[model samples]
Target: MTATTEINKIINEDNLVYKKTNLLLDNEMHYCPGCTHGVIHKVIAEVIDEMDIQNETIGVSPVGCSVLAYNYIDIDWQEAAHGRAPALATATSRLMPEKYVFTYQGDGDLASIGCAEIIHACNRGENIVVFFVNNAIYGMTGGQMAPTTLEGQVTATTPYGRNTALNGHTMKITEMIALLPGTRYVTRQSAETPAAVRKLKKAVRKAFENTTEKKGLSFIEIVGTCSSGWKLTPTQSNEWMKENMFPFYQLGTLKDE
Candidate 1:
């Protein structure tokens, strides 16, 4: 056998401890180094593979950093206008009740512009999952302040640090959504470490599984990092998120039924 063939044979004979999930495509991730979007994507892909629901899953992509999520995730996807992912997901779940439909949106898309659509969808108890990635800035369209921007946080719009008096309080959208009667499951997680990523994967799995039971809306808010937007290295961004974001967001299940 040729050298390459021999190497492949030997590797195949060895035990595989870990490997990328097939649900994630081979396309290079467009997220900046240290950004948590890649990790979240991997966690979701793994969940989909583990549940054996790849063939029955449909994802709604929002018009933010994850606008091209379809490129990286190997599954059927639909693109929604800015912040309207939950609305599209609502329709997708209603029209194809058998399929697992989820919306992947960033803070800019969800909390800022798509606020009304998301609230109404959850209030109506649409049987779908909504994955909200809160990085506190508009990552795709320049690092502008977002509705979830932490108090005292600095961004392109709030260059001198967020002044609550001027910019208003940081929105606790997850907490607000949990109060809706239509919401069946609501959780906040992060992807800063292995333990955190594992927890996030479990949360994603739970949200996906809830759809099968015809549970009302399931919302998962992932408090993530944006290295480029934060003007910090990936490592620093994670540290900063832990120090600043976690305290306000508070990771845990807000509600589950």
Candidate 2:
């Protein structure tokens, strides 16, 4: 089958079933078809399952598409107000030092509104892990431009291409977080393929380990596809991300020790 044909298959209703990993439960996913949120959820689930942290981990899910993440990951979960996942997570992590704590947030939720919280949390060397999903556009709220939306990328607010002169370039969270004295580990990965998904799961597990080991703040950014927001088929979105975005954002662990 051609690329478009494969993309159609990826978007077909039959393709949306939960992985045997069951990262996502019965709660309806608010994400669009071909959205990578499910894939990221799978990575979190697999890591939790692999590390046996389901009973000991608590996730602080923030507003945005990931607001429903707590419904998916079968662990002690808490919901934070918009852009406050890090603050809530910091409290939880400090209150229960023995428990693994992490926050899952989207580009808009993290880079745009939650920026100060995340930076301060990392600065204080908070013992928490952060899983940031950077898809450039706001998946919720109908594909609005997010803080990480690249220049020349169109969105609900930037239909004529994101004007770098006005909007600025995409925010580089991995780099930003790595600079914080509190952060001991940072990595950026993708989830477009099975191999990539496996790596992403490892990165998540590593983040959890940092908190569990009481090392310090750990940050992970998953460069994912917002198929519906980007106005492309799943396959095309994946390819576009690889060719156009990876060179700029790149992927790999930025800090670890």
Candidate 3:
């Protein structure tokens, strides 16, 4: 046998278990090391690839760390103002009812400035999926405290840690939206572990599937870590998230219908 034929035979003997999805660009992601955004992006891309919806999928990228998502996800994308992704998604989905539309947003944009837009979109049963990334701090705009910032959590705006007595309590936007009649699915997940990644992928796939089922709305809240913003290494940030963020936010489905 020829050397080239031998090499090709050996390569074919090994089964490939994993490969990067083409739905994501070859460009290096801009997310900080230990950040879950990269993982979340991979999961979303995997789902899009598996569902064969890349050509039919439209994503709304909101102002935040993920504002550059359009650069990474190789699909139709629309940029929205800080916290206005839902509004844009609503319009896009309405105009192209056959396309799968989703919004990718962070805590600052979704829970703080764009809270009203999301709330009303859910209440109105907009046929769209909302991917809410809750890292608790304003990652893109320095480590500022956000609406979902945990009480006693230190941030640039809250140097001494968040004080509920003065700042009010953390906003549970996912829970609030789940209670709306227009919502069809709502789940809180994380990507801190291998098991969590699998669950997150399933949740995302379900959310995407719901868009085609004529569901009013689907919301997936990913409780993620911001290593730089939180002043912790990637490893330490995951530990901090588990110990701090999980207690209040909790995991699992808040609603499903």
Candidate 3 lDDT, 1-257, residue by residue in tens: 11111112223455734333477777877889998889999999899989988778889998889887887778888899888999999999889999999999999999999989999999999999999999999998899999999999999999998999999999998989989999999999999999999999999999988988998799999999999999999999999999998999999999999
Residue ranges of candidate 1 with Cα displaced over 4 Å: 1-21
Write the residue-wise lDDT of candidate 2 on 93-128 in tens digits: 878888888899999999989889999998999988
Backbone atom clashes (below 3 Å) for every candidate? 0, 1, 0
* TM-score-based ranking: 3, 1, 2
Clashing pairs in 3: none
Better of 2 and 3 by lDDT: 3
Give the C-alpha miss distance for residue 28 in model 1, angstroms.
Answer: 1.6
Candidate 1, residue 97: lDDT: 98
lDDT values for all models: 0.88, 0.83, 0.90
Q: Residue 41 deviation, candidate 1, in Å?
A: 0.7
Candidate number with the higher lDDT (1 or 2): 1
Scored against the true structure, residue 15 in model 2 reaches a CA lDDT of 61
Tens-digit per-residue lDDT, 1-257, candidate 1: 11111122224565633333477677777789998888888899888888888778889998989887887777788999998888888888889999999999999999999999999999999999999999999998889999999888889999999999999999999999999999999999998888998899989998988999998789999999999999999889989999999888999999998
Candidate 1, position 14, lDDT: 58
TM-scores, each model vs. reference: 0.91, 0.88, 0.91
Worst 10 residues of 2 by lDDT: 1-10
lDDT accuracy of residue 163 in candidate 2: 92
